[model samples]
Target: MVQSVKPNPQGGITVTCDNKEEHFDKVIFTSPLNVLTKVADSSLFESSKPKTPVEYLGVICLVLITKSSLTPYYVLNIADKEIPFTGVIGMSSLVDLDQTGDEHLTYFPKYVSANDSYWKKSDEELKSLFLEGVSKLYPDFDTNDIVSAHLHKAFKVQPLQVLNYSEIIPDVQTKHKDFYVLNTSQFVNDTLNNNSVVNHVEKFVNEFKTESNLQ
Candidate 1:
């Protein structure tokens, strides 16, 4: 059960987690808005956290091994489908393509939220489908050449890009004197943006320290 905050006469709050008790004068809540809603009512503070208006397609990438590197280009932009989801990235994409070596790393978009017939399939079934799609994308690639394969599923890998999100997310500081909530949404759209996140962090740390009286 979520811990509750007592009346002002008590002057202190009790928080219990996994049978452990801890006392604190202040707390900074960093849980996601969705998760925070599941928590019990807190009269200690009144903060409005809005539901994030973004969603994304989940993916289960299937990495393929090759004797010779696929392409010096890190990514193979799969224009349109003969496949689902989006493009394919070379497994060797991270390694220097100019290096004198054989073997390449490549994986394809094996899952798509919109076209999720594959996710319903068994792992082995998915692997075959992945191999087959990869082969189609790279005709020279032999399905048998894939000596090993693995599945990597990413949940909410990135946020769906939309427009005009400025009005939704509010300032980090709540109307309450001693409460704040911060998350990726505060920094960027559904996905985190570099400059905004950095700026938000700097401001948040400063604000938090000022409110908490930190060193």
Candidate 2:
């Protein structure tokens, strides 16, 4: 775990990890935008700290391995309020069956507020709740068909794109020299996905390269 970040007297930045401390000429923080505020020293950035109180949505996903396929579609967007999950991703629809040993893989992803009470639910409880929704979606779905199931939770996975979000989004370059911030939160215009993540990384790298050449 990163304990703290401070500016070195000589040059660069000093990062204190749980086991050791290290100094680098340039430091790029890629964690969730809100997380950086907790682990790093805001004062190090002088007056140009990232905006605070950014709203984010956490995700609780149920990964299911089943004897048969769930849906022919790759993605099913849930619109019913009764459905606890936001969407169902049929991984098997895209991935080759040989890779999964002919078993089906499905993902039930639910987005919730950071302070959502659902986060407190036990894995078994969440699994049951999600399975209930699945059963409703597919009347033929049987518990016996499920070979295995697992729960995965991640906090601050989605940044709420409020009006004029670009105006408030943090700059990659901070006030302090050689310190930068690049994260999924920067993905304001597009939906947060693997493609957007790759695009953001490429844009960040190109921008960093341009800035470095100027210096």
Candidate 3:
């Protein structure tokens, strides 16, 4: 795990990982916004700090392999507040069944606060609650159809896109020369998805490469 990151007085940046330390002429931080602030020296990024710190939403995703498909559509957005999960993703709709041994693959994702009680629930408890929610969607859905279940969680995967979110979003470039940050927090205009992430990475790479050529 990375312990600290500070600008070297001579030049470049020094990163301390565990007991080892390494120096780099250029360092790109791809970590989450909250994590970057905690691990790096605050002094290095004083000028780039946002007027208000960006807020994020945590996700609890449950992946299930089953003998039957849940829905025909690839995505099912749940607007009902009573529902435990945010949405359902039918992976089998886009993926080839041959790859999954003809099994159905579905993802149930819940977006909640880090302090939400659901976030602290045990795997077994979450599984029961989520599965119960799924049952409500399909009255005939059978437990026997479920082959396996997996749980994955991220504390700050999605940014809470509040009003004028772009104004507070941090820039990829920082005050520290050769030090930069390329993260999801920069994804302001678009939704948090794989395509948005890839687009941001490509944009950063092009910008960085152009800057590198000038020096």
Candidate 4:
């Protein structure tokens, strides 16, 4: 894992990985923006960082393996604010049933902030709440049909867009000419998806080559 990144006086960049240092002419950061703030050395960038720290929302996912199908629809979004789970995804409906041995797979996802109370709940508590929410969605939902269940969590899933968000985004090229930051935080007027990521990379490559006079 990359431990930190610092400026090299030899007109390049120095990156420390697993305690060893490596040199590079340039580096393109693709990880979550929040991670950069943590890993980057204070002396790495000579310019000021973002005035307002960008906030991000995390996610909790409860996956269920069942003996039978739960819902016919591929995806269901719960608009009602009272529900604990925000969305239900039927994985078996999208993938081939044969791959899952004819069993059904479902996902219940909830988006929450870092300090949300949901993070304090134990596994059993989360499972109970999610099961109750699922039961409300399908009154006939049977607990006996569940073969197994798993829980997953991510701390920095995506950025929370705020007022004048685009204006506050850091420039691709920082004060240090050899260092650059590129990630979803730079995305404007586009959804965060594979296509948008690919497009952003392509544009950055073209612009960088022209600006640096790379052959």
Off by over 4 Å in 4: 5-28, 40-48, 174-182, 193-215
Error of 1 at 208 (Å): 13
Predictions in order: lDDT: 0.58, 0.83, 0.85, 0.82
Candidate 2: minimum summed lDDT over ten consecutive residues — where? 43-52
Task: Give one clash count per candidate, in the order shown.
Answer: 2, 0, 0, 0
Residue-level lDDT of model 2, residues 60-116, one tens digit each, is: 999999999889988888889989899999999989999999999999999899789
Instruction: Give candidate 2 regions above 4 Å deviation.
Output: 5-28, 41-52, 174-180, 205-215
Candidate 1 structure, TM-score to reference:
0.56
Task: Report the C-alpha lDDT of model 1 over 65-166, residue by residue, as the tens digit.
Answer: 666755666656565666643567765767764552556677676436645676677878777776777667678866666656787776544344456665
Clashing pairs in 3: none
Q: Write the per-residue lDDT of candidate 3 for residues 119-159, one digit (tens) a residue.
A: 77998899888888888877799989999999888888778
Off by over 4 Å in 3: 5-27, 41-47, 175-179, 206-215
- What's the CA error at residue 35 for candidate 3, in Å? 1.4
Best prediction by TM-score: 3
lDDT of 1: 0.58
Candidate 4 per-residue C-alpha lDDT over 92-135 given as tens digits, one digit per residue, 9 for 90 to 100: 98899899988899999998898999999998899888888888
Query: Which window of 10 residues has the lowest lDDT sum in candidate 1?
Result: 3-12
